[model samples]
Target: MQENQIDHLFQQGFSLHQQGRLEEAQVIYESILKLQASHFNALQLLGVIFLEKKQFIHSINLITKALQIQDNQAPCYYNLGSAQQGLQQYEEAIARYDKAVAINQEFAKAHHDRGVALQELQRLEEAITSYENAIAIQGSYPEASWNLSLCQLQVGNFHAGWRGYEWRWKNSEISKTAGLRNLKQKLWLGAESLQGKTILLHAEQGFGDTIQFCRFTRLVSQLGAKVILEVQPSLVSLLQNLEGVSKVIARGDPIPECDYQCPLMSLPLALNTDLNNIPGVPKKFITCC
Candidate 1:
């Protein structure tokens, strides 16, 4: 194909990609490669489409080919990092993200993703620094802030972690997946007086988070609040017997009217939990069936 024809096909493929028609875009990119084996855009974007499709190895191969054709493209390294991350090759992903950042100092997303890779590798301090760098580059980056919170929590920096944890609400993906309650009631974040009032403690994360934090329900009740706990359906039977909980409602059930609300994960922060004084697991909370 002539140069103009290749550019036209590339534009068409990119347009399809922007429309999220990955399969069609992949075909067009592949056609471009058939005419020009070393076509940089075709290889790079096809690799990205494969990465989106979860074809990690193919994604890596194509992206590597793109890098060979043009080593200076920062996005190529970033996409290569993503493919490595998909395969759980954290160290490789970090190296690729590092290269991306080295190529473009303003690459905030590369720094953010490098932090994710570092966190996966259990390098919490380094991950925190990486997240901070990303935040410094892009102050309004919700994902980096949210991840920095996790790294802080992992290292037992409760004050900063929980404070930053609130950024999860700013992340559209997390907010969508975790399904934040849209109640107009105020969120009780420890300082609120629960005296003579009903408090709704809803589970906003996975089962493990609910199990771990349900211990706070008793503490809430101890403060003279009517504690209504909402948990996943699978845990309703187990938690129904929990002491101090006035009512245990399964998720999806209509939540009773409450004066305040809080996500279960935030209970620790609300209760002023720390590494040394973290609440012990309730003896009967976990038992074999």
Candidate 2:
């Protein structure tokens, strides 16, 4: 009978999870947990479910309870760190990730996650090293590489950061990796003379990135080229006067043929931009999402 009840609880939880109702699934997991405190699966599931729901404290509590039952569980520590990250408890998250890495030095994810927490706390250099360690342990995790590049760029390592930042284009979220109607596909690594070339630079990722990279439109134009920038529609009017930009093309227009293409974020590295060389922009690029 107890086994049947546990099975039923699991089924309910799985059904709710499949339907994307994490809160409801958590309640069912909690009910099963009350009857069987030592249920490891329920414990871990509830912890992760709560984490996904952004109930940071509750997720920490559930994971910590799991840790008490099984002190050697590396995943619990990792999950605990993730919960702490959501709560913006950087120090505690670092401690939890430290324990997880100590238990399993080869745990690349833990190192990367700790780096994210450190980066959030403004420990940029330390975060870079942590990301490097993660790369050493397991090379080329797209998320880690993307984040490492951000930390690098934040600290003015434009050369290295921009090179590494290219990995972001491969992320599944980037929809235009496949060829568009008429634009040529290229990495934009300081190549393809911008002189007289009609370069189409397509934007990728968040609003901040578009704004941040928009400064390059002027740079590209300075090279004696026509710039057709494909950016977010909302940013169209805002980017009208960015330096050197010949045209702002938001969606729906037939993509124009260009001699070259560049990911919006790739220009800084291609140009070897630094603190002194970093292009200044107006209020449009300065604003955040």
Candidate 3:
């Protein structure tokens, strides 16, 4: 096919790619590659489609070939890094991200994903730095900020971590999975006095998180509030008699009337908890379940 014809086909494929019609885009990109095997754009884009499709090896192969055709493309390097990351090749992904940032120092996404790759390998400090770099470039980058908070918490920087944990609400995926409550009551993040108030402490994550953080209900009761604990259906019976809990109910049960509410996970931040002052059931309060 003529160069102009190939260019037209590439434009169509790229348009489809931008529209998220991956299968159609892949077909056009493949057709372009068949006509002109050395087509850099086609190779790179098809690789990206493969990456999106979760065909990591095929993505790696095609993107590698595109890099061979033109090694200086920053986006290609970033996409290659993404493919590597998807395959759990953390070290390789980091290397690719490094190359991308070397080509474009202001590549906030590259820096953020490099942090993710490092974090996957349990390199917390390095991941923190990379996430910070991403935030520095793109001040409004929520994912990087959120991940940085998690790393900080893992490293015992509870205050900073919990402060950043508030960013989780800004993430759509987390908000959906956590089942954000649409209550009329105010969200109590320990900023307001809970004195004489009725508060609902609801589970936001998994059963494990619910169990671990439910201890905060005692602290809430200590604040002169009536604590109503909401947990998974299975744990409702187990935690019904927990100290400081005036009521325990399954998640799907009707929410009782309350003046304020908080997620169990956010209780630490709400109560100013730290490593030195983490709240838990006292030995005297422990009972045989």
Top-scoring candidate (TM-score):
3
Candidate 2 C-alpha lDDT tens digits along 1-289: 4798799888989899879898788888888888898887788879898898888898898888888888887888999999998988899999999999999999999999999999988999999988999989997687788889889878867777888877766555443542233444554668667677788887766678788878777877888889888887898899877778878888566778777777777788778776556677444454221
Candidate 1 wrong stretches, greater than 4 Å: 281-289
- What is residue 199's positional error in candidate 3, in angstroms? 0.9
Per-candidate TM vs. native?
Answer: 0.89, 0.78, 0.94
lDDT rank, highest first?
3, 1, 2
Model 1 C-alpha lDDT per residue in residues 1-289, reported as the tens digit of each score: 6899899989999999999999899999999999999998899999999999999999999999999989998999999999999999999999999999999999999999999999998999999999999999999999999999988988878889988888889999988767677887799898978889999999987888888889878888989999899999999999998988999999899889999999988888788876655667455563321
Clashing pairs in 3: none
Q: By TM-score, is 1 or 2 better?
A: 1
Task: Output the worst ten-in-a-row residue range by lDDT, candidate 1.
Answer: 280-289
Error of 3 at 135 (Å): 1.2
Off by over 4 Å in 2: 1-32, 173-187, 203-212, 231-243, 280-289
Listed per model in order, the count of residue pairs whose N, CA or C atoms clash below 3 Å is: 0, 1, 0
- Among these predictions, the greatest lDDT belongs to 3
Instruction: Give the higher-lDDT candidate: 2 or 3.
Output: 3
Cα lDDT, all candidates? 0.90, 0.81, 0.91
Clash pairs detected, candidate 2: 218-243
